[model samples]
Target: MPGQLTLQGKVSAGVESGCLVMESGGKQYLLVGGDPAVVKPGAEVEVRGVLKPDLASFCQQGEPLEVSSAKGR
Candidate 1:
């Protein structure tokens, strides 16, 4: 888990269809490839993931994050 990052933020609904996003360090990151139950808008979450910039995303809003796991904070 050395490269894994733990990010804490409030989930927000992305402008695009079916996208979930979170803001941390003044930057927006698109959350993907995780449990739908955890990746939700308006939920405070501590997300553990890696920056998957190459990950194909429908949202096209923020940098894509390949979620390893996520839980409510």
Candidate 2:
């Protein structure tokens, strides 16, 4: 049920390839293999993915919405 929710946040850190750090609602989350367009630090994003059981991983297999452009929506 957690993955069914859409989370809005800003990219805080673009770490190594396929790994990114984001801050959502005051909480920090690590998203892997995320779209680079939305992984840029300070970039706003709408993530639609499932949170792993570890609670440290956010898997984004679907498309992500980058705040850089309103067209992505």
Candidate 3:
């Protein structure tokens, strides 16, 4: 997890695409994994994870993050 990063933002669950998204430092990231029950729409969250650019996703709006941890902030 050398390249892992910590991100804090308000989560937005894509209604149509079914992806969890977080915006931090003006950048958007498509979130994956973590505490699913905690990652929800309009919730403040702090996540520790690494980016996976090659990961294919139906919701292609943001960079994909393989989440290591996610918790309510």
TM-score of each: 0.89, 0.54, 0.92
Q: Write the per-residue lDDT of candidate 2 for residues 1-73, one digit (tens) a residue.
A: 4345456776655444454666667666665445565456677777766555354333333223222221112
lDDT string, candidate 1, 2-33, tens digits: 67888999999999978999999899999987
The candidate, 1 or 3, that scores higher on lDDT is 3
Highest TM-score model number = 3
- Arrange candidates by TM-score, descending: 3, 1, 2
- True-structure lDDT of candidate 2: 0.51
Q: Give the TM-score of candidate 1.
A: 0.89
- Candidate order (lDDT): 3, 1, 2
lDDT of each: 0.88, 0.51, 0.89
| lDDT score, candidate 3 | 0.89
lDDT of 1 at 17: 79
The C-alpha stretches of model 2 lying farther than 4 A from their native spots are 14-18, 55-73
